[model samples]
Target: MPSQKLSTLEKVGFGAGDMALNVVISSMMLLITFFYTDIYGLKTTDLALLFVLVKVVGAIADLVMGQLTDRYTSKGGRYRPYLLWLAVPYGISVFFVFTTPDWQYSAKLIWAYSTYILMTVMTAGVGIPYISLVSALTNDPKERLSANGYRLFFAKIGAFMVTIIVPILAQKWGDGNPAVGYQAAMAVMAAMGIGLFLFCNFTTTERVVHVVEKQSLLAQLKVLLRNDQWLILCGVCVTGTVGYVVRGSVAIYYAKYYLGGDTETVAAFLSTGVIAAILSMVASTWITKFYCKVKLFRYTQIAVAAISAVIYFTVKPGDMALAFILYFLLSFVVDLHAPVFWSAIAETIDYGQVKTGKRVSGFAFGGISVCQKAGMAVAGGLVGILLSYFNYQPNLEQTQFALTGIALMFSVIPGFFHLVMGMLMFKYRISDDYYTEVKVQMRDSGYIAG
Candidate 1:
């Protein structure tokens, strides 16, 4: 079971596609809730519920796509075909995601719900299998680490650039009106979606194949669920996933309420946060090599929590400058953990195999994907429902209570989740030694590697 070979170009291509996917999808989530509440006239509760429903759909898509891609066999490999077939649909849904309409609120809700759900479902279908394919592409653990590091690096760039420019797109597209900004953001988002699809099409290729292609979904799930390592990692994955969601969802209100900044300034603040997040990629790359991925994850997340604590108490009106800097630091923590999480996933794949005496990377990671989305859906829904609970008014300034909630959302909620994830990571057993040992055993046991 010596490693199968491929040209270096193929490796770069696959990694590039992963970067493209992360950037566009994450940026859309980062911005879309604001779009619904402000630009598109969707109520907070409605939009949140819509996203929750979409998350459910997306989860199913991941599970099904996992099974399909596991069985996938094409010249391009199991993953490439989905990247090809789903490309158009991915772009099309995203285009419509931001598109505005003349329809009534009910009609608009229908349209928005359908489109968002479609985007999430299609995205998960493409994304999970694509991600799971990483191990198959190269069994060299460090190469997988390098692949994830490179992908996260570009993803931050994409996220940073998107954050910086998205509001500008909104302004230019919306022509100074929130309503128009909604329409314009959708168009821009759609364009990014196309870029994502085409980039993957041109850049990536799968190397190794899923030999257990005929394994039934039930069989896969049973084994996947039985793996203790997968269960342990899921804790960190789900908690941290909620940490990201709460921070992202609350940013709009944090800027609007805590800093009392105008929309443009808030967007700028977020752009700055993205800048901080970008730098974390480099830091994470080196940190992963020296410290255990799980350990670094705990340290960084705790650091994020500490930063959030600073913001929660220190933020004051007319202190916008100070708050922005505080958030930039918090964003650094957010960015720092980005690579740690993915690399952790790669390790968990090995962890699962070693523990179960079977390999089901697709199912294990797919389950994690589902957990992440579920956390997000819950957090986003809670954010929305809570925004409405506190009587958040988009057109006007928030009430004192609403403002408190916003601050807490960004500070306490995410802070708490990060702490929980840290504790969870402590229980995780995967180490570089464990991962390398697992790989040695697998390769010896006739597992194919490319």
Candidate 2:
């Protein structure tokens, strides 16, 4: 069996990986839509197509990367090597995604597609292995949960940087050119991401190595499909991600237009949300110590839906203080599920191994990744379509219809998804006690090596 304890350093290192990954993730969630419209000048319809196609490509890449991880291992371990191998390319891809070329409109669209696809591919290159690393690091469910708390806490720190730093830096750097500012600012974040990945690789060690059975892709899928709990988590990933991306993608617009904010106010508003999420990480870690994580996950999301409705109905346009307060509360409760959700992935994988007698590690993680991407795809398309429907115009004073649409995207529409997410968790039954039983079974079955 894998060691149940991880040192603080190692936990921080593991956390750093997500922090690094969040450079891309947070940007995708928070800024990509805005950047495409305002900075890079892509039409909303073009953006819709691009988001859908790129995520489709990303889902495929996730699957391919999954298989590759299963087939490959080295002295640095199965998953950590990817951090070393792909760090530079990953950084470069992030830079390219934000780069604006002064080309023809069609050329710009092509560049957008090319760079975005490249970024997603590179993201899979590191992301699949990075997530799979959590299982490799420990077999203890509680340890996994604690480590995930660290991971998410740092992830939000990365997101906080994106929300607080990116806009400010872009505004300063671009100096009259927002595109140049975004490019320069993102280059710095990309570099930090590369460094953080390397730190994660160096500081963390994989102790729990699964004796994964060599199987065909179809066979692996069959095995994964049999895990009902895994399926539930898949649903959770999709719906939660859709809720997250939809709200996040619209936050800047909400802040700038609905709240009538300038650049600083916009940054503060987005920062408020990220800071609340950051605090939620700590709160979740502490709260789960005293309560049922599964229950917490279910209730917090439902609360999010309720609070979101309050925001929609109660907060009027330009009601900045009330908006910030409600949004902070909404953001806080909405993310309380994060640590539980990520840690539960490994638990479900363990449950799957115990149930199916087949250890489907890499592909299972990949499947979760794919679900997240699918959610992003759906959310991105929704944002684009909704923007078009509402006649959203970039850098222009929005029509009342468009402003209301932005408000709904930020609050009610995404909140409905969170409601679905919470209800789906009623089907998830993997408690800490149940996971302990799973561990005992795996140990007895000799599926896990001591």
Candidate 3:
């Protein structure tokens, strides 16, 4: 068997990859909608089309990147090379997405579409390989879990930066022009993203290289479809992501309009949620040592749904203190499933191999990415439609209808999806004990090295 242990430095390095990734992800979830509407001057209908089209393209890019990863291996390893090669491009794409050109409305829309799509493609280039790198790091499930814990912890740090730093910096830098401020602030973030990706590339090593079979994409997909556990994870990904994206997208609106907060208050509100998520990463790591990870995943999400309902019913507009407290609790509980969910992807791959006798790696990782994109698409569409329905007007006092819709988006509407996500986890069976058996079987059968 390959070495099951990862050094602290190596774990930190792996974590850095996700941190870099979250610079984009956190922005997409938290700031993109607000940026488009309030700062960038996109109409709700245009924003809806932009989100849907970009995600559709992103899904396709994920599949293509997956196939590319499976077909190629080099001195840099199967996944790390992408980080090195795409880091600059990825950073540039991020900068461009936030850059607002002084052009006509149609021209600006085209630019938005072009830059967003490019960023998504670049994300796929790095993202698929980064995720699949987990399987390559080690076959030991416990090590995978620990590494993922670190990964998620750092990912939250990256998100925290986006929430706390971006708005503050943008306001300061732009002075009078919010657009200029956003561009400058994101430029700093983009540079950090590139550096972190390079650090990840240099510090991590891949030990468990699978002997992948040569199969058509269609054939590999067929195999994956048959793996019920993986399918369940995909469903969980889609539903959970929808909830996450919806809540994140509306948080700024909730703070600004619903809570009657200014820029600093909005920043503080978003930072509170992210800080709670950061703590949840550590808490999940500790809790899983004794409690069943699967149970933790299920119950915390269920708790999130209940907390969300409480926030929706109890916290009226301008109830800043209650809103912050409930939001913190909701954020903490909702993310308890994250490390478990990521680590479970590697386990489900192993389970799929043992049951079907075919090793499917890249496409499986890619499929999860696709499911996440699909969730974002659904969430984005909903946000766009709901904003229009609520008669939301940018940078103004919202009508009661608009404020209520924003509140619902932040709480109840997304909570329903988390509820379904928790319920779906009930069918997932790959506990640590079960995964240990799958490992033994794979090794004994020579599907993996003995």
Candidate 4:
């Protein structure tokens, strides 16, 4: 049997994968919409279309990559090899997306679609495998949770770097051209992404191997459809992602327009939330040791909804101090569920296998990825539509209508989705105790080593 506990190096190595992924994930969530309109000169409507279409392609790519992982194995194991082979291509794709050409609107739109699609496909190639690595790393649920805590902490560190460094780099490097600055900044981020992926590939090992059965896609889908617990988790993923993406996509806009901040204020505002989220990862790991993770997941999200309502009502435009304080609180509370949620996905796969008499590992993770993309599509389209409806013109002094829309998007709108996410968790029955029971059954049945 493989060892259950991982060393700090492996944990940090595993986390570095997420930190790499956030080069694109964080940018898509936090900067893409702003980049497209304010920097790349796309209309809100075009931006909306681009976001939805790109994620649609990404969703399909996720499933394909999942199947590839299931079918292929190498000396490095099932998932880690992808990090080594594709890291350079992934970095190159990210760089190209930020590269704005001096072309007409029609040609530029085509460039946008091509580069964004390429980036999304590369993201799927690495992302699916990276997330699935947790299962192969260990059978112990506690260790998975701990590793995920490190993963999320580093993931937030990536976001912190983006919020703090990207703006400064862009401003200083662009000299007078914001577009040139953004391109240069993102190129640096992309190179860091390549290095992190290589580090993750070299330092991590897949020890707990599952014998993934060869099955047709349709057969796997049927088995997955029967997993009620997995289904519930999928629902939770969608709602939670919608909340995260919507709020995240609007944050820079919120700081710039509603809060009336310049580049410095925007960076500070975004950094506040990310720093709070980083603390949430640490606090969550410690809290789950004493508190029930499930109850914590459910309650914290509900509390976030209340906090969101408070922020919307209490903080007026230009209330920077109050906005920062409330935003920090909301960011911290909302993410308390993240590590629990990710670790739960692997548990759900085990639950499904024991219940359905088959193991569907890759596709299960892929399905979750698909759900995430769906949420992003919804959130992206919504942000574009709302901005257009609010008559938001880029880099312009805001109208009252535009300011209110930004505030609502940043707080109440996303809060409602999070409230729904918390309610959905009520249906998720997996707990540490319950998962222990699952392991006992799997062990006795000879599916895994005890």
Candidate 5:
């Protein structure tokens, strides 16, 4: 049997893949809606359509990539070769998504759809493989958890960089034209993504190779349908992601308008949340060693809902200091579930295999990705609709009503979704002890190498 342990270098290498992937992930979460409205010259109503349509394309692409990973193999292994082949394409896609061409409004809208859809496809091309790569890396649950800790930490670092550097770079380089500035800044970020993916490709190895039984698309869906734990996770993923994306999408606007922040303050505010998330990754990993991870996941989200309510009621307009402290607290508590949630995916797969007497690897991970996209779609649509409903105007002083709407989106609305997320987790029954029992059965049955 392959050793369950992973080297520190291997852990860092694995983490780099998420760092690279976050170039697009963080952008979509933090910058894309704002970019379309303020920089790229798209209407809020149109932005809703663009986000939903693009994610629909992304969902189809994820399913296709999942099937490809299951059927194709190379010397680099099933999942890693995509990192080598798709890195450049993915980086280029990121650049194009941020690029703003000088064109008529209608033509520019077409460009937005085309480029965003293309980026979504390219994102799935590598994203499904990178996420699925975790299953191939090691079978040890603890090792997977540790590696995910590293992965999420670095992922936040990527987000941290985006929040801090993109605004500053756009301001410095745009020469008063934000379109040109965003393009130039994201190009630098894109190049870094390519290099990081290459580093991840070179340093990581696939050690736990599961025998993926051939199944038709319909058959695999049936297998996943039977997985109750996975279904719960899919539900948690959607609700949790909706909350996350909503808050993230509104944060820039909240910082700039509601908090009355300048460019530096905006960057600082965004970075503070990411900084909290980075620390949450570390704290989660440490706390899981003593506390029950499932409990931690359940409670922290509930705590986030409470914090969100607090921030909404207490932090008034232009209350920068109070807003920052509460936002930091909210961000920190909200993300405590991340590492646990990611590691739980692999365990759910194992549980599925044991229950169904078959393994569905790539498609399972892809399904989770689909859930994430679905959440983004829902959140994105809500954001656009709510912004329009609230009469939000880009780069302008807003009405009292509009500012209140933005505040609700940032705190109360997303907080409600997170409360649902935490409540749903009450149904997830897989503890570490239960997963060990599942693994032992797999080994005795010869489903995996012993």
Candidate 6:
């Protein structure tokens, strides 16, 4: 990819797509627990198990889609086809997942497996490839950062809005029936999902088209594993994701029980994170220009971990004001990593090609997606097991230990992952100079003008 800039129109569309993506994804993440237990009428343990299963299955689909994406090309190019193929179906499935009929737990689980699995396959297949397309879109390390950062900045805004809106919609709708609220919420979000995927597909075109190769399955896997930078960075991303999934998973609990609020209050707190994320990422554009990305990530991670630890100990049952304040600070630091890490992934595509003389951005990110799904899977199982062990009861008073346990999950788990991510990132070798060399050598568009 070269240093060419996306057009102003394309940029607007891309940013909108990013915003809608996060809005839907975060709304799901932020609300699914309550949805499962209350609206779907599934047991908490069953709900958690379902969450884990869907993520793991989706992770597997990500690998297949990634490989196919790298191997398959068309007039539309390597990745854009997925944006079209999966967009509508993905939205439909999301709606179904959110608003299944009230039935026996067994029947509900079956529907859960069916639509959730299908949705995961289509969405992950499309998403991993679509995200990887950024590598081929622009090779300017800075441009890549700006595009992804700008995208995330707006995405966080959408997430903030959805966080505020979804619960209210759920409440207003649930007054009639909780499932109906869930159904309405999903329908609205699905519309957004379908629209965004379509817009992103048409707005941006692919560059740096790879010569499609007929290679054995094993060969593709081998190529990806051989890329040293991808291996390390993907590993770090997985660990960080463990932290993220855990935090997101437990944040609901933290807000509701530890703070003694309802789900609506939890949504309000998450909205705070969403709001802070926008400002932080927008501010990061200046920081990215002056400061090294790895260094910024390191400082941010340490600060997040340290502050989280403090908040965990200091947050009292009544200190809602202080808790919100501390959480907002953590939110700012934590959101900073989204743009930095994703922008870094774009760089890894260049580094891998430079070192191996082969560009398999999809394959590289397939492995990347594995870490993400793995984190969710492990956290889901552990959370289920933890909830079961702690005697977590819905529609009743939660145990003190369970509340404390959930708080630790948010603070300690991500804290540890951040520590590991900080260490792994120190080894990332692609600097601005290295990226320039890679584009020049390949005759890619992002080669900075001399």
Task: Estimate every model's Cα lDDT from 0 to 1.
Answer: 0.73, 0.95, 0.95, 0.94, 0.93, 0.74
Candidate 1: tens digits of C-alpha lDDT, residues 152-256: 766766676666667777777666675667556656655665566566666655655534535677877888788777787777777887888878877866787
> Of the pair 1 and 5, which is ahead by lDDT?
5
Roughly what TM-score does model 3 have, to 2 decimal places? 0.99
Write down the TM-score for model 1. 0.93
Residue 214, candidate 2: how far off, in angstroms?
A: 0.6
Measured with C-alpha atoms, the lDDT of residue 108 in candidate 2 is: 91
> In candidate 5, what are the lDDT values of residues 1-450, reduced to their tens digit?
444898999999999999999999999999988999988878999999888888899899999999999888899999999999999999999999898989999999998898898889999999999999988899888899999999999999999999999999999999999899999999999999999899999999998878889999999999999999999999999999999999999999999999999999999999999999999999999999998999999999999999999999999999999999999999999999999999999999999999999899889999999999999999999999999999999999999999999999999999999999999999998988998899888887788852
Q: How far in Å is the alpha carbon of 294 misplaced in model 4?
A: 0.8
Q: Tens-digit lDDT track for model 3 on 1-450?
A: 654899999999999999999999999999999999999999999999899999999999999999999999999899999999999999999999999999999999999999999999999999999999988888878889999999999999999999999999999999999999999999999999999999999999988878789789989999999999999999999999999999999999999999999999999999999999999999999999999999999998899899999999999999999999999999999998899999999889889999999988889999999999999999999999999999999999899999989999999999999999999999998888888889888888787752
lDDT of 4 by residue, 1-450 (tens): 444899999999999999999999999999889999999999999989988999899999999999999889999999999999999999999999999999999999999999999999999999999999999999989999999999999999999998889988999999999889999999999999999999999999888878678999999999999999999999999999999999999999999999999999999999999999999999999999999999999999999899999999999999999999999999999989999999999999999889988899999999999999999999999999999999999999999999999999999999999999999888888999999889888877777732
Give the deviation of candidate 2 from the true structure as CA RMSD: 0.8
- Candidate 6: C-alpha lDDT: 0.74
Candidate 5 lDDT at 237 equals 95
Of 2 and 5, the candidate ahead on lDDT is 2
TM-score of each: 0.93, 0.99, 0.99, 0.99, 0.99, 0.93
The global Cα lDDT (0 to 1) of model 5 is: 0.93
Q: Where does candidate 3 stray beyond 4 Å?
A: none
In the predicted model 5, the residue pairs found to clash are none
Per-model clash counts, in order, read 5, 3, 0, 0, 0, 5
Per-prediction CA RMSD (Å): 2.2, 0.8, 0.8, 1.0, 0.8, 2.7
Q: What would you estimate as the lDDT of candidate 3?
A: 0.95
Tens-digit lDDT track for model 2 on 333-448? 99999999999998998899999999998899999999999999999999999999999999999999999999999999999999999999999999999889999999999998
